[model samples]
Target chain A: MKTDMSIRMRTMLYGLMCVLLIPFVFPTWWMVTSSVKPISDIFAFPPDLLPRTYDWSTYQRVFELQPFAQQYWNSGYIALLVTAGTMIVSSLAGYAFARIRFPGADAIFMVVLLGLLIPAEVTIVPLFQMFNQWGMINTHWPLILVPVFGAPSVFSTFIMRQFFIALPIELEEAARVDGLGRFTIFRKIALPLAKPALSAVAIFTFLHSWNLFLEPIVFISTPQMFTLPQALTQFTDAYGGAMWNIQLAAATLTALPVLIVFIVAQKQFVEGLAHTGLKG
Target chain B: MANVTLSQIKKQYGNTPVIHGVDIEAADGEFVVLVGPSGCGKSTLLRMIAGLETISSGTLKIGDRIVNDLDPKDRDIAMVFQNYALYPHMTVETNMGFSLEHRGGTKTEIAERVKWAAEILDLSNLLKRYPRQLSGGQRQRVAMGRAIVRDPQVFLFDEPLSNLDAKLRVAMRAEIKNLHRKLKTTTIYVTHDQVEAMTMADKIVVMNAGEVSQVGAPLDLYDRPANRFVAGFIGSPSMNFIDGVVENGRFTAPGIDLETPSFTAGETSRQLICGIRPEHLVIGGEGISAEVSLVEPMGSETQVTFSLPEGTIVGVFRDRIAAKPGDILTLGVQTDGCHFFDPLTDLRVE
Candidate 1:
């Protein structure tokens, strides 16, 4: 009934999969291995599957070159704040759009959906001008505030709205009869049941905030204020010759937290996206 | 306990009216059921009483307070949804005690009430488990437990047993009825299933297309339906209506003629519908000839579908009928069991 593959068929399938995995997994493997390889051997023939000679000094040089730890903290805190802020804003907006009935709700939701149409690049200049007038340039305010409140969160709000819409309305009715007001019902019943969608939003907002290069580079000029993605490019010698091994080492460190987060929350993330009701 | 009264309660979605002024009164500790086929607005009327849906117009009173503008929580009522609507994330105890918690009950008080409700619902052992961990019937009991934990003034149930299997539905039906008996709380139950309405309701409100067709005690409605709709809706197999005219003390149609009841004699040479329950059709006697079209043996009773020259009618016989399709069977109508209705208005003609 299962129609399971034979062992030989499975072996061949695994072999095909391993071969297919090379394009996706090999880069991370190379980046990790290349971080430990001697600078001269990084581009060596056949591309040493393992490091030929270990150069632990590259990791030391990564920290010595710039305020690497400070930059890591900047990215870490910004991502966390963005994740939390986006979660709050999006879940509330989503709940309102999905559940609450009011005049012009549909029109307002359509306007919000318009945010999904305009790419971030198209709004960057206007946003930069707006933030400049607010004296928010060179601060983490733009990095955090824009994603949490602006276009980036539109997707999160959309996801949350879809999730909240899929939820049974009877639960809220029952909660209302249980003496919960709208806010209390949202907090106690709706929000607790929204863990999957929230996780999906968290992962998305965190990764988006962490990998943000254009915004940080455009907004932040201070060395210590650079996030990981921006800081990774700062690992250069005086002559501006790219410090290959040091850069790779910093990039490897930059990838670590995101990797760990995804590993920890992959189940919920997958389920959340799947349950977003996007599939036909 | 409180009595619920709806005086001309109406509802409309935008310009479209759903409940066109329904009036129902459930005396204190009475079990009232709103029942009808789908889209009959029975559930909507129940929701209006529970304060889930806004009443477009008319006065809704819980006890003596007009509750038209009050929130569901302020109405002092608890409802069990059709799906049970147990908070999936919370344990049974927390779910049962959620209302009390919202009302600022002390933890000890909440725990005591939850314990009492759990014990009554036989969910004491399962209080620590989540709703997803319980069976359909257990989840149903948990929903009931949640309702009873707060001891609200009234209870509302919206097809609460509909999600359960047949056996569980019957068990839970009795359990709910027994619970109502013990608590003696004013309860309004809504279901489309006539069997549930007939077996469980102290009074049944039969609705048709957003209007209350009849409201009476179960047997009273069954014995003497006020209208044709109530007669058709209150029975399991449903009453079969044969269109005929009463003339010279005989009800005559295309290929059928029968002795009319004494009360129906005054309407001579008038068009009428004679409604007869499936069980009231006698299999053998001096009567109209009908050819058996289908025979369904349902354990204790054999349900036979017969084709009278005018129309098809169903009959339930206690004795096992060996008649197959194409066999002619003489069927007599129980004279006392006959109901005469005006064909034009579909109203009972006494």
Candidate 2:
């Protein structure tokens, strides 16, 4: 039944795809190769595909600049906390909005969705003031609490609500007949079936928190508290002139963990977004 | 096992009423069927009895206690949904034992009960598989097994076999009937297929437009429907209706005249509908003549559609009818099978 293409046609198609992959793949390749190239050869005319000379010192200089290890750990743990916290808060809120019937539910949902329309730039001042009053101005609390409970989670809640709405109501009804309370039904029945949606939300929240730049720059000041994105900008000379090779090495380190996470979970990430369920 | 009684039970969504006040009774250990066309509120009524839907007014009693406001789990009634509704992630054994686990049954007790239900349903080998891995009929059996594992006071099925193919449906139908016979548990099953109702029910409740049209034994309802709806709804191919008037001990229409049954002798010159089943039309006898419009043959019988000046009618005959379209066939009415309905009220004229 499959109408497979001729070998020659397939070969040509693959060749075309390889050519098209250049713009996306070349930048990362350049960043990696340029990190080990001498500073003079980084912008050499007719750029070298492979480094003619290796300066392995740039990788070590990346750690020597700022508290790079500390920043890396901060970004890692903050993203982990944000992903976990967002999943719980959004799933509970989503299940309630999707299943529970109450007065003013639609009105409340509309208000929550309004959070999505407002950009983080608009609320940064009031948020900074609020965190300053709580003595959390230079701490990681603002980074963790804002994304988990604030505007960023609204989108995750929307995705979870949509997934729950598409679920069959008969399953819940059958659980009720089986002597389960509302919370028990949600835990034993609904939550387990919502794995795909939850993974999708986790990936989105983790990536968003990992690459966060503006929030760290605005709220954090000391080098020990700096996240990776903010620390990547800190690799500069005393005159504030950018350290080209060291910064590229640091950027490569920042991009490595996320690339590995994506490659490992890409299957679930795609399936989660498509919202396929276990058929019965 | 227990008896279920509905006393003027009603349901409405906000301002619009769907199920008008309905009253039905299923005696202890009885197998009752609620059969109707789609959107006839049959499933709604069954859900109300299952305690899934709140009663707007009146009382519902399962055995001796009023269950109108009780939660579905507290009512001790188990329900099988149309789609099976098996927890897709759980294995069949865990699905069958889920309710017992929630009820704080010991692990050994839960396992034993699940094993017994699985053995009864022929699902012992499939216990390790998830619902998605099983076939449709197997999933249906697991759903039934999940219900039977509870051993509740009452069993409710909402179009449980409607998702199967024709052959599997018939097989499951017989299996369900046999299960009912063995358990003798009070059961309320809702389906739109009248064949399931006719073949499986000890008592059939025929509903139309959210109201009970007739409630009786299978043959009793087929032999004597309470009104036009019941008469048409109960039988396959439906009953044929000929609008006519009784005059001079005969029924007369535009192109037909036939002798009236003895029951209609006193009601002379009255307008009514003559109801006859297809199997009741005798092929060769002294009766009104009709032109054969279409003829279809099964291995056992031939179904012939006849066109008269008044309207068209169908007849099923055991004889292999050789006549094709445009052929004229003489039709005779069996007087004993004749039913009279008042045309204005659409009610049987006793």
Candidate 3:
């Protein structure tokens, strides 16, 4: 009963799961294989899964076409800054919303939640004008500042608030009896136990900042100041046609590191996200 | 250790009142337990004393200071929560010593204190383990260890043993009572379990519907409950209440008549709620005739449920009853052991 049923069930389940995985797996497969294919074979009548002639030149052209290294650094540092900044700002606000009882706290939280409804796309035009007026149009300030203080961080704050709300109130009460102030309790007790939520928030915030497209194109004009997303778009012909090989190659470089990291720590990444009270 | 006084303590949420001007005073080193059914304001009163809840419109004095506005940190009290509330991230040692570290105690001092508490709780070997690794009983001991390490002015417990299994709760109850005896710290405990209040408290405060019904020793409240609420709430299986009328110095109901030397004027014509504790009813007494409905043998004592003239009543007896359901039996209510209360005010008339 056990062995025959197990064999049949296992094969059927594996087949179904693999079939369901096609959409997600295919895009990544296409991106990696096309990045390494010769320019002609990329659009051949029969698409080549393995390039007949490897075009290593596209990878070299990816770096040479623009200040891709500097743009990579721009994306890297801005993501780090946004992650760190969001962790601090959202955690403090989230703790207050969850644990503190200041006057009009619910009203203040509702006003903060208004940030989530006003998408960055809706506010981009005015934000561009505002940053341009401040002579900050070409810098990374808007990309970093807007996420840390605006809509993206609100979601992080919401995740963190939900997590903190689930924490046993007794721990804080015990801390109070132990003579720790509100800030001390938050720093020592609440934040340390909130590592799962913090990691989840960091993953989300970093990804959001790294993939910013419309904001970078609207705010940045200089190639030297361009982020990776803007730089990926720059890998095109002078007539504005996409150099698909070079773009794909650069996209591989831009996306591979995070993919590899996520794959390696997939257990933590998935579990951390699940523990943030987001899933049913 | 210091005396804690709550004067006209009231708790109201917006316009709705929860605790309505209840007063209680705990002498230095006294063990007080606030007990009642759920939503009876017992836990709320304890939280107010702990400074976790605002005292709405009352003055709370710990020792000599008016602590209405004081922060919980400034109130100098330790609390043991029902869930044990040990820091899940910290080891038992760190969980115990964390407060001392924040209070600017030296590493040596914190270590010494943690060592002392661990030894007292027999947690020395388990100090390095986190809270999640500990069993429920171990976590309860660790919670008590955290409370005692500080030696705070008052110790507050909110149903600290309710989460433990029945056997473990009994062991922890004795441990807590012994610990209170040794430390002699002013302690206020809250529980919905009557047994915990009866076993552990020097004074038991019985509350109902946001009001203090009675405050006395465990035996005092058990022997002489001030009102119908107290009489019914203070004992196991609860005191069986039978509605009856008072006339000719005897309370008469549907099927039974009980004598009450304590029934007074203005209560003669009024309907009264007559109460009889299960233990006070004598089985096989040839008094009031009853039919045995069920018999539950609890090793040393047997609990017999019988249908009286008024309603089904339960009686606990030390003697084993070989009676079966539908067996005709006679029972007697020891009038002295019974309590009487006016149904209108629900207050004791005797």
Top-scoring candidate (DockQ)? 1
DockQ for the candidate 2 complex?
0.92
Lowest-sum lDDT 10-residue window in model 3 chain A: A264-273
lDDT of 1 at A108: 97
Global CA lDDT computed for model 3: 0.88
Runs in model 2 deviating more than 4 A are: A1-9, A276-280, B264-266
Per-prediction interface RMSD?
0.4, 0.4, 1.1
**DockQ of structure 1:** 0.92
Better of 1 and 3 by DockQ: 1
Greater TM-score among 1 and 3 belongs to 1
Angstrom error at residue A99, model 1: 1.0
> How high is the CA lDDT of each candidate model?
0.91, 0.92, 0.88
- By TM-score: ranked, best first: 2, 1, 3
Q: What DockQ does every candidate get? A: 0.92, 0.92, 0.78
Backbone clashes (count) for model 3: 1
In order, the candidates keep a fraction of the true contacts of: 0.95, 0.95, 0.95
What is model 3's DockQ versus the real complex?
Answer: 0.78
Report per-candidate TM-score of chain A alone.
Answer: 0.95, 0.94, 0.96
